[model samples]
Target chain A: MKRRAFMLSVGGAAAGMVLLPRMAFAEAGKIDWYTSSDQNILDFWTNVVKPKFEAANPGVTLNLVDAGDAAGQTAIGERALAAMQTKTDPQADYFESADWRLPAGAADAGLYVNIKEAGLSNYSRINPLAFDGDYSVPYRGSQVLLAYDTTKLDPANAPKTFADLVTWIKANPGQFIYNRPDKGGSGGNFVRRAILEANGKDLGKFKIDNYTQEAGDAALNPAWEILKDLSGSLFDNGAYTSGNTQSIQLLGQSAITMIPAWSDQAIQAINTGVLPETTGLVQLQDLALPGGFSRSVILSNGVNKDAALKLADFILTEEVQSAVLSELGGFPGVAWDYVSQDLREKYADVIPTTIPTFPGGDWEKAINDGWYRNVAPNVDRAA
Target chain B: MSLTPASDIVGKKPGRGLTGLLLVAIPVLLVCWMVIWPIISAIGRTLWLPNDGGTGRSFSVETYKFFFSDQYSLNNLYVTLWTTGVCAVLLVLICLPIALYLRFAKGRLAAYVQGLAIFPMFVPSIILSYAIIRVLGPNGTVDLLLNSVGLPHIRSPYLTPWGPVIGLVWDNIPLTVLILISGLGAVSNQSIEAARDVGAGRFAVLWHIILPRISNSILVAVSFTVLGIFSSFTLPYVLGPAAPEMMGPFMQRTFRDLNDPTNAITQAVIAFAFCIVFGLFYVRSVAKNRAR
Candidate 1:
């Protein structure tokens, strides 16, 4: 009888060892955050946010999975969609996606949780337009700015409008460059902005979905003409750089004096000594450049729904927004007035007043296809 | 010993048949699971549009039509074919001599050259691309060297098809050289000596005897190089011109950047079809060589 009692005691102890941890974990849920943010932003989150969030909510652990950079994010999104289709739990509770991909890529596919229904407090602080059917919150904003080497070109003489830019390119041939539209969104944005410039006040019509072939041809004709005309004046007589980073590299090497670049990327490049400090950025006054916000999307079927909501709230707080600006060189997710006065003044030129979101996927594909077919062939004709 | 009956021998045939089935079953199952299933799924994807919420499930040739009808799409095939042709020729011309030396010559220099030839195999394709860019880009190492000697700065062709061709050749040389060296090892040196004794010069021996023996290896090298160049993404994406891009990068761009999986699958199917043609040639060459 004593030996039987001892065996029961050992069995009870083994069960207790396993049960205790489970009971402890039951109190504090874990959040898995997958992001495509760069290394610096990831570092900021891990070093700064993770510890504080965990400290405040005891026993809670924040797991940050690096989904990859821009292209990698799309791949993750595709995987997440596949998981959702199979009724399996997605690998991530929250994911960060590029702004341009929203409404067509992730948001349209119903991959994100509705923030309003989730009762996130900071939802109101975000620009309502940034809300993609209340499924995502804008985490950071970037504008396509015309960056130039001040050493090569006088800043005062910089182009103020599309027309002025064309005239300047003609006079200083081979001094300006833009990447291929299909390769990088920055170049794509430049083409879209040029289309806007070409169409004048017909931007709304072009923004519409399901354009007939005749309608698309007529609307995009002037833009093609402008691109073909400007091709002769581009760097290397219309041989465009293949990617956005290449354009910045050429500017740094003084191979070209002017190129279209992302505001945050250009500034970050300067800070990292990739571009010399003499490099300056300017937004065209007459033409509103394409600007959009990268967003934090909470998956609907995420494991830790409450913890994910808490984490989203923590990310949108003023402290994190300030860090995003100071550390990442990104425009704040909140309004400019909400950030420090110094930051507002420092980035006044780049702080986008007229941010234009990308049209849906179909329109984007049409635009890319049209540029390749119509404009690309005529690029070197004049040269 | 007593003689075995015919019925007894027939009874043992079932046991041998069972053993044979056991041996081949695992391999057959593995091939079906790993290769055939995926190929079937890929082919299915080409036929059907994905039911991405809006689009209802239906069989369609729209994807294939879209890909073939577009000139931009067709240019990708042209670029891939051109690059593959150039790289195949270049790899053969460059690797054959080094391979011959490694097989025929016996010295420290041959060993050193062999080491140098295979050294690039260790370097990743992406790193090799960047290295080529650094060496051949505008105002790069080559330009710098030329400038030091007071020569005019020549524009870099590194941003064109030539650049990718150079990188592809450099990357593929090791495999080609290894194959050729193995083929040369099988070429009997005694036969070459006998031919020489009969008034066959070095050129005649190489052309008449060595070439015929190693033709299989040459075919293997050429086929592999063509396949590698056709499907190569990193070298062409990093080095080649934006327009007239290779099929690999073009498919990726169409799929991810354009977010059109159907069109991308169609392109993949076309690429697979090309690979199958080359693969058949490889199989036939090996079969013929083995028969001989």
Candidate 2:
């Protein structure tokens, strides 16, 4: 009798587990998305973006993998490349990066069906800078800025140019920070801007820019001299090379007064209570930072390219745009004029007019050579 | 130097039994395939990169010129060699006394101390670097406490190259001590008593008896430690800013950073060749000692 009772109880428990939840979710189709967005934002993409898409396309399931943090933007692209090379099936259906890695073989993936052919009328909504061949599309963007603690300095006395930022760093020893370009932070862009500023070139003329012998020597010589003169005042004699996390921590502790911070880092610091409310971000007036792009590319190794386009179209929707901006802190890379006033106002602070880009085809090579591995300890050592 | 007890049973056949052979082959091949292969491929791609994407990517000097002509790369190499050489020697010297003490000391207390000595090995290098910084940085625990105690604050350890060297040596000590203890164990108590009876003082006994008996193990441990420190990447990357860049970072730049696998491979092969030449001598020394 006791054995029968236990068996009956076991059967009852199994039945309850099945019947207690939304059993309709099992009928969904799976669309795999591989992305490098942050955890919380990705959770929003999975929970908010997936369900909304699945609700529209009932049989499709969405499986979103956090591939970005697992390795990096490069490694994720390499994994896809390997999959493509080996002709592996069921490779990630969609791929994305803050910067479109593997930009060389993007079109060779033989995956993405054109947004026009895929019936994506919303392509008109995206910016021309982002709209291209079916291989990839810009995800979203945030303007890189020089973030600082206003409490440490009056706004009236705030830095207006890269030169000013450098001066401020020198005046306050051991309190400035930023990551290197090779280290995956936008340090390269800042370094380039410094070179551009030293050359006295107009910001608009900065494109596919080559670091000439003159540029490498003349522009960087002053920068290096200044850095060398100011080196003793840097954080631990200019030894503390750190990413946003460490820099932010130091900023919170009043250890660093300045950094070349991206919008997301500043936003995250504010939200997480790392940055005080008095903290401020300012775009450099003289030198534009043409760095930082979030490219959400269409990748279909085996899944439905047509279906993937449907998802892409859905993601670029005004409603989805609003959701992504509010939830993920993503600024639009489209003809963002049509966005709601609320969206415009929220992202207004972060967006720069012309974010510096790799001006030349060999942009990475230029920066790696130009920036001294994106970390010219002395501005003079740029070559 | 493992003995073949049943070699007489097989006249001309010179080999281990199946179990012994499998044990050796499995581990040896596994290492060669996994670790050695990737390392070789990385170096190969760097050194022998084709002028054009086709058949044989023959040898070239462009990669080397690109690597060494730049002051950055040269300085990085300088940093790596200086730090590794200094730290390895320091690691051996510091651990020798600790190893001797652990071997000679009595009771469970010594075991506990020895355990504590090795505990840092379990901590990740990243975490260990942060802890060192927190204690030794300008605003770290030491400075904060010193200030509170009414003493003038001292400079941050981060400002000096010693910050990284000390950290590296600290990380190496436990393994060094372990090697030394195992080596010292091979010195039978009989040998010590024999030396003492001969009117040999403590220093004489250690120099003649202990040193000679355990020299093989010491050599083995030193070989591994020096190479390990040479290959170490992350600790120094974080710890020292002013220090010259090391070989690991240099290789990373040449291949990974430059996307030039050919030159990177050549440099790696050079490093591997350096290791092998020394490794042979080290192994030969051990074999010679064990045979005695």
lDDT of 2 by residue, A241-307 (tens): 5344555655665656777766666776787687888788788776566565566666655455556
lDDT of 2 at A75: 65
State candidate 2's DockQ.
Answer: 0.10
- Alpha-carbon lDDT of model 1: 0.77
* lDDT, each prediction: 0.77, 0.65
- Model 2 lDDT per residue over B33-88, tens place: 88888877766666666767687778767776776686776676667678778987
Clashing pairs in 1: none
Model 1 regions more than 4 Å off = A1-30, A36-87, A98-111, A127-130, A201-203, A206-212, A379-383, B1-31, B38-69, B197-200
Q: RMSD (Cα, Å) of candidate 2? A: 9.2
TM-score of each: 0.84, 0.80
For candidate 2, chain B by itself scores a TM value of 0.83
